[model samples]
Target: VNLLFSANRWEMASEIVDDLNRGIVVVCDRYAFSGVAYSAAKGLDFAWCQAHDRGLPLPDSVFFMRVEPQVGALRANFGDERYEDVDMQVRVRERFDDPRLRQGVPWH
Candidate 1:
């Protein structure tokens, strides 16, 4: 599933780059880091998650919104989908702090 997520992103790499080339602002709701975060939350090796996306085009910038675990679950409508629980969110949140990631913009 992680590979599929990465593949799905790669599939759209061209379009994203094209928009940038044309000076069109492209705001992706989710990107490569999501795959690593979600997969790592499932107990997969973080290194493997990253290796799976090696060579992918890095985004010019990314925005990561930090919220309390309980709030995140509530916002997720917890249980409506996988990884919506507080425990999983905690894991995902930690991985989001990976040093490989660049500074993220703030969002409420």
Candidate 2:
């Protein structure tokens, strides 16, 4: 499913490219980071998650914010979804903080 999620992103590649070409900024709620972090939290290898998302178009800027567990739960409205729990989010956050993920990206 993680691989498929990464693949599915490319399904909209042309449109995203076209929009960028037209000077429109694109905002993706979930990008490679989320794909990797979420799946990795679910027990997938972190490296494998990163491997699958390689070569995708890079964003001009990325903003990664980690909130407190209670904050995240409030923002996500706890129990409304499977990943809204504190435990899952903590795992996801840890994976996102992996040093490997910072090697080549401009993180703000």
Candidate 3:
């Protein structure tokens, strides 16, 4: 199915919301938060990354999968994914941990 090959596709998220609105208990494997975090990790503007997903139904709960970078890289390497590269992974980790994203931190 096209959906299988298009796992990271953002538009699929809208379809998911549509399903939920129709009383489907649609559970997303990765949703806007993950998309925003990953893309923003790659230097995308955080707000711009989120603009497309604005007003989507918020999840009733979230389960953050916290894993150490070393573990993540090993998992990624097994699949031949370069995103597990040590330096790049560190940047992605930093992107998530950066306090600039926290409330009350001045962007200026």
Candidate 4:
């Protein structure tokens, strides 16, 4: 398991998972799921996002935190912090609700 904050697609995650064939777990902060959400927010096809993540090592346990864009924006607000596009965040959150994204990795 690889930890990636702000998950991307499975291409990189799969590479990392494939690199480790031993009985050790690599902890990751984020993974392919992030890409699904972010890309979905961008109005990209959720299936396409998932397709890009195919063949990645599946996490034994997966968790998702359902959040609203406004909530996220408030929480992410920090002085001197680089800003994010709130609209994009909303789109990403919507993508998380996509059936494709809901399929794999039972959420905790």
Candidate 5:
């Protein structure tokens, strides 16, 4: 699934580069880092998850909007997805907060 997710992004790589070259700002809701974070939370090796996304276009800026797991669970349709459980959300949050994962990225 992670490989498929990365491939999906790779399919858009050229278009993203084109837009950037033309001075158009591109925004994405989820990118490589999210893939790594989520999969890592599920017990995948962090480096292994990251390796699949290697060489993908790096975002100019990365923003992580921190929300408490319980608070997030309160949001509408929170349980609509497979990873929506509060416990899973907590694990995912910890993965995102991992310093090794954040290295070399300008995260806000």
Candidate 6:
């Protein structure tokens, strides 16, 4: 599944590059960082999770919206997905806060 996510990004590489070349800004809701963070939270090795996304175009800016786990759980449709549990979100948030994962990205 991680590979699939990376492949999905790779598949869009050409279009993304084209947009950049045309001076158009592109925004992605979830990029490679999310993949690594979520997978690492699920017990995958962090470095291994990051390996799959190596060489993908780096975003010019990254914004992380911090939300309390319980608060997030109260959001509408929060439980519709497999990883929506508050416990899982807490784990994922920890992973996202790791400085190693934020390296090289212009996080806001």
lDDT of each: 0.78, 0.82, 0.60, 0.63, 0.92, 0.91
Query: How many clashes does the backbone of model 3 have?
Result: 0
The true-versus-predicted C-alpha distance at residue 55 of model 6, in Å, is 0.5
TM-score of 2: 0.87
1-108, model 4: which lDDT tens digit per residue?
112322444346656666567555676676677766776676666676566566767777667777776776676452234326677776767676767776757877
Best by lDDT: 5
TM-score of 1: 0.85
Clashing residue pairs for model 2: none
Model 4 stretches astray by more than 4 angstroms: 1-21, 76-83
Ranking by lDDT: 5, 6, 2, 1, 4, 3
Model 4, global lDDT: 0.63
Candidate 6 lDDT, 61-87, residue by residue in tens = 999899999999889999999999998
TM for every model, in the order presented, reads 0.85, 0.87, 0.63, 0.68, 0.96, 0.95
Candidate 5 deviant stretches above 4 angstroms: none
Clashes of each: 0, 0, 0, 8, 0, 0
Listed per candidate, the RMSD to the true structure in angstroms reads 2.8, 1.7, 6.5, 5.1, 0.8, 0.9
**Tens-digit lDDT track of model 3 for 52-73:** 6556556776555667777876
| Candidate 1 clash figure, as a count | 0
lDDT of 1 by residue, 31-92 (tens): 77888888988988888988877776676667677888888666635778876788888888
TM-score of 3: 0.63
lDDT of 2 by residue, 4-107 (tens): 89889878777899999999989987788788888989998889888977877878777887687768777645768878788998888888888887667788
Top candidate by TM-score: 5
Report how far off residue 72 is in candidate 2 (Å): 1.9
User: Relative to the unseen true structure, what is the C-alpha lDDT of residue 95 in candidate 2, on a scale of 0 to 100?
Assistant: 86
lDDT of 5 by residue, 3-73 (tens): 99999999999999999999999999889989999999999999999998888889888988999999999
